[model samples]
Target: MSYSIVVDHVSFGWPDGTTVLDGLDAAFPAGRTGLIGVNGSGKSTLLKIIARELVPGSGSVSVSGEVGYLPQNVPLGAGRTVSDLLEISATRAALHAIEGGDAAEEHFAAVGDDWDVEERARAELDRLGLDHVGLDRTVGTLSGGESIMVALAAQLLKRPEVLLLDEPTNNLDLDARERLHAAVGAWQGVLVVVSHDRALLELVDQIAELRDGAVRMYGGNLARYEEQVAGEQEAAARLVRTAEGEVRRQARELVETRIKIDRNARTGRKAAENNRVPKIIAGARKRQAQVTAGRQRALAVEKLEEARERLNEAEQAVRDDAEIRIQLPGTEVPAGRTVLTLPLARAAGDDEQVAGVGGKVLETLVVRGPERIALLGPNGSGKTTLLKRIVRQGAQVPVRYLPQRLDLLDDRLSVLDNVRAVAPSASVNDVRARLARFLFRGDRANQAAGTLSGGERFRATLAALLSAEPPPQLLLLDEPTNNLDLASVRQLSQALSAYRGALIVVSHDLPFLETIGITRRLRQDRDGGLAES
Candidate 1:
């Protein structure tokens, strides 16, 4: 297969002297490629380097044609119009001037050969399910998911030969995700997307994983990549077992060799002491035995060292995706306990929901016991607002709210301090130990929360909530898996499994909700309407 983009010995790092990528080399074929890695693996950094959004510390990236990139966070401003966000405002203005009988040369120059820029822009936006977003509308009016789709449409309008998307599905609801997936499926150029969305990854032609400072490519989609990795891990596990046995055997043989050597020495000493044979013969035999013993001991030690090296290499092949171990039994709610109750208003019309805007519910709903609830709706359908309201109204039990933006953390505080702030009665060592279960161990617990990557910040925020006083019997999580990588999502699921409290999670990640054992699924309409699904 031919390559569309080639990264040669690329390296990048932050100003803190923290290295993200080192001597990394990767290539993308002329098709959709999904980039996968744990948080802090530099997937976004690599994409930026390729897009020239950020200069690499060393090496270079070679692309076949123009590159268009959609960053993870789409910058939104209230004054910025949709036309400006699409980046065709100038062209549109020039086209308008030309149409109004002003055939100025500069207007023609600005318009270039794209007199149909408006139509093309509209077409792209429509393709991405953003036809309702008027070009003159301010970005502040759009929902987060709408803004993302609009930004993607902006990239597609350029029609670049190479396209890079960083977590494009983030903040998007299920429908928007399908629309984005359809656009990706229809792409005809070299496209690289960094995402953990299984549905988005399923559309990729290949999977490129960044781990341990290197890039490894697997043919086909995420499922194929996972299958291949699973097989490799299974083989590695067998190798590890075999290596362990070999190491044990070699260790035993080494010990046995010493015992034999000592026994021979004793035998030789008796011969020398008793003069069982001629002194000369005895000396010669003893010397020969000593020589043989020395050789045996050298071989035994060498074998043991070799076995250990093999074991180490075999173990390296296995993945060590750390899981968050939430073991707070205090968070457990009684089976019949009422968690929270929210009143909802009546629904307006059954009109299709806008991308983000939604009405508020003013009626009533009750959450009881250790129930797991999945809150699903269009973006801005008051899901997050309702979560905040629940926290504001106060639950029957101690409640903790994890917002979509993860703004609960004090950026200036270290992870340890953040957790301790919530649990003042807990000792520093106890907080540190708990943070370690959240994958912030040792010195890592001392790092400032402001400097953490998206995944790390989520973990830190979660650690604080779980570690809070009274253990937070009612947990409200809004888009909890937004910035999390696939492994981290799995880890989150594992952690939630240990929570015996009530959970109301606002998310579009159906698979994740299923994994967490959601007991009830509720959908909120554009109005304050809440219906059980």
Candidate 2:
């Protein structure tokens, strides 16, 4: 029960009255902890409060030592250099000036005792797979993945007792992700990471789940947590069934008891009217019967209420994640039908230049029926460029492409409107009904696409793409799981499972690709030729 960070009676809300964490109390111990939750479950907000990036509305947080936080989105200054990001620019400058024969007191003060600051900076960068990123290089020159890695290096270089990382693996490619996983594994101080990366979570000593505005700790890693949850859910389900049966039985008994009591009263009244007994005696007997019947009815009602209460309690234990259930028969392509033909390589007699092909041209890539193809490549290997070319060239059937940025959505338009735009022929009611299957119901379906969380936006975008006007038989997704949480990843897999169409997905998430049952795996060679891996 020793702790590194403590949050007491914490409460936070936005100006728009969106309550995130309410009276939430949690403690993080000195070990690697994986923080996970569904989208918008306040995981990021809690991390920010712990990091002092945002102030909590009430309550307090205490940390045992210095804290370093790497936010989900690392703010990049266009003019800042890697040295500046690592926070050693001042010290490095002072050392350089002193070495060049400047006796300013400020230089001596800035250099302090950290004469090896430059070497330490380089070591930290190299540890995080950023050795190639020079200290003097501008941050703008790095890719998104490299920028995040550099930010992490900056935190590591600080040597803080506590480190908080929010979605640290979000933008990292496969190699960068591996390096990050290694860093997490090697950390000796208190480390808490909020991420959707399953591989990263596997390295954590414990899993802290943020759900329903509370944090629950589970000993061990993500796999252990899932096993526990699955078992708990099964037990909850059984209790619910038993509770439901009891409620139904009690309801039936209550009705029957009332009927029997009424029948007895009627019989007594008839006997009294027939003068079977003296008026005084009959009146007393009737009063006694009335009291007994009243007690009986009250008892029945109490039992019924107790049953309902038990049922409610049982239901609360179950986590109800609504599944997306939809049959898109229109999207089904016949086994013999051609879905698409993209010239992944150059054509003979065609002068079109293919980047990175190195003169090794591939034949026209043909997709038929409902084949699931995984498009794999390193960053900047022209995977996205090839996808764009395919989209521009068009498909043999109705096609839809969901790009990495999710820019397909009209920011101002509601989710309902966005989906309806794609399915112009479908009625509003029809579109909304389909959206409900994607977990957008009622006012949720009316939310502006721009205001949605990363997971919500992904769901909305998928809904729109799947529910297009002509019912796309050829679906293309680029890095679909880039920012999705684990639950959202499962949701995406479930949604794609129901999709009976040809799919070409560009992704580095091998586990996710497995879930979708990819029929073929195609790798983009360094020379730009697409080959089966």
Candidate 3:
């Protein structure tokens, strides 16, 4: 039984001295392994270390064979065609042919006499669900989902011994996700995938949990891991309560013993002259002293035990309650009869004289109070385009738009400054206080917006959006759950559910949409139009 990959006591930290993985030990065989953790829990970092992109500060990582890594975001080289990348193998064969080495005939034979590398490349593309994509097509022209498929096809062509994927399902539609899942399930190699998708985790044979700079393995899927966590949390809470009660009882007993000792010492001194009384009192004092000392020692031991138990309980509870950080300011205003109304066949202007018209996307849309609408569609299917058009048409209504990217924020400004900038008329102190409510307290408020984590950035954006004077009656979220941890996503879902305003969200997270009460869905057609179903 040979191991595909082995990580022995590996520790890693960023150049900025932020420690992530510590004393982590794990081994991977020829099967699927799911890595689950909270945001900033070092899932990506650990994967990179395995891929040899990042070196560990301590310990060692050993790989038995070639490793293929798929980054979260595929970076395509400019002007590179699918055939150009694939032809590298052919080029190596050609080099062997020119050198006339001992293995030249073998290389030529393996590549075939005619060496139709283009045909082989096309077949590989078809295998990865890119049958429509041309072999000569530039990677730059591909959509987000298509680009991911192309990258995957390139890797599969080489057939590495182990594959490392980070959030591979992100940005993919339901159909594309299913296709990728099938492709991965069929692969014959070691797989280490870092993702929050519960559905995807079901395909894995084992799950590894990363928490507090350590990794632990469990033999099951995400559902089973969640069940185990829930059980541990309940047990930890019970232990904590029990320890607290015992501590309280011991404290009371110690106090009573001290009081009795004081009373006995006073009584012993007062009855010094009485013969029988003095003898009895002296014995009482001796016994009282012994009892007091013993009680003190016992209390110390009990306190130590209780402290250790409480610490263990606290750690377990932290693992159990994985909550996302999302807090929107409460609004007293009720949603109006029509939160948004769009015109039929409206022209969305682009550089080339109105690149498209709204038909399936928007043919007279109207949203009512407290209605959760999910804007579901493929990449470049006008989800964000429809959102912008609605916002422009519904200017009369108070709206809060959280864009997918935080490019709307000023990077140079502090988190507090950004919040204050959103509503300059408000006092700085008041804005800072509001920010603190979102967990940006004290010095954190002074930190630059650029330095904040993905979760913190979303919180800052939310703070800015909610700080408006009249408050927003309609909330527009564009991929709001993207790049957020499971905990943060849950918090955002709960916060949105609590909001009285209407919600118009465009997201790829089906689970999040279902949780946020999206009763209506907007899907886009292949011809750049939306269809409401």
lDDT of 2 by residue, 1-533 (tens): 89999999999999999889899999999899999988888998999999999999999999999999999888889789999888899999999999999989999999989999999988988988777889999988887788888899999989999999998877567778889899999999999999878888989999999888889999999999999999999999999999999999999999999999999999989988887798789989989999999999999999999999999999999997767787788888888688888765643543433343333344678888899999876665678888889889998898889888888899999999998888888888998899999999999999999899888888898898888878889988988887677888999999898889999998877789999999987767545667666
Total clashing residue pairs per candidate? 13, 1, 6
**Local distance difference test, per candidate?**
0.88, 0.88, 0.74
Q: Which of candidates 1 and 3 reaches a greater TM-score?
A: 1
Candidate 3 or 2, higher TM-score:
2
The residue pairs that clash in candidate 2, if any, are 356-527
Q: Which stretches of candidate 3 lie over 4 Å from their true place?
A: 85-117, 273-336, 344-362, 392-394, 408-417, 423-448
Stretches of candidate 2 off by over 4 Å are 276-281, 334-338, 343-369, 411-414, 441-454, 525-531
TM of each candidate vs. truth = 0.92, 0.92, 0.83
Quote model 1's TM-score: 0.92
Runs off by more than 4 Å, candidate 1 = 276-288, 345-362, 411-414, 427-433, 440-453
Q: Give the C-alpha lDDT of model 1.
A: 0.88
Candidate 3 C-alpha lDDT tens digits along 1-533: 56788899999988998878888898777788898877788889989999999999999999988999898977787588766655454554564575575555666665554455556667878876789888678877777788887787777776788999998887776667777888877877899998877678888888888877777887788788878878977887777777677767766766776677668667656665454556666777767767776776677667767766775666566444433344444453355576667765544532222123232445667777667888766665667777887777764468878887767678899988887776888798888777776667799999998887777777777777777656787888988766776667776776675567777888777777888888777665554555565
Question: Global lDDT for candidate 2?
Answer: 0.88
What overall lDDT, based on C-alpha atoms, would model 3 receive against the true structure?
0.74
Worst 10 residues of 1 by lDDT: 353-362
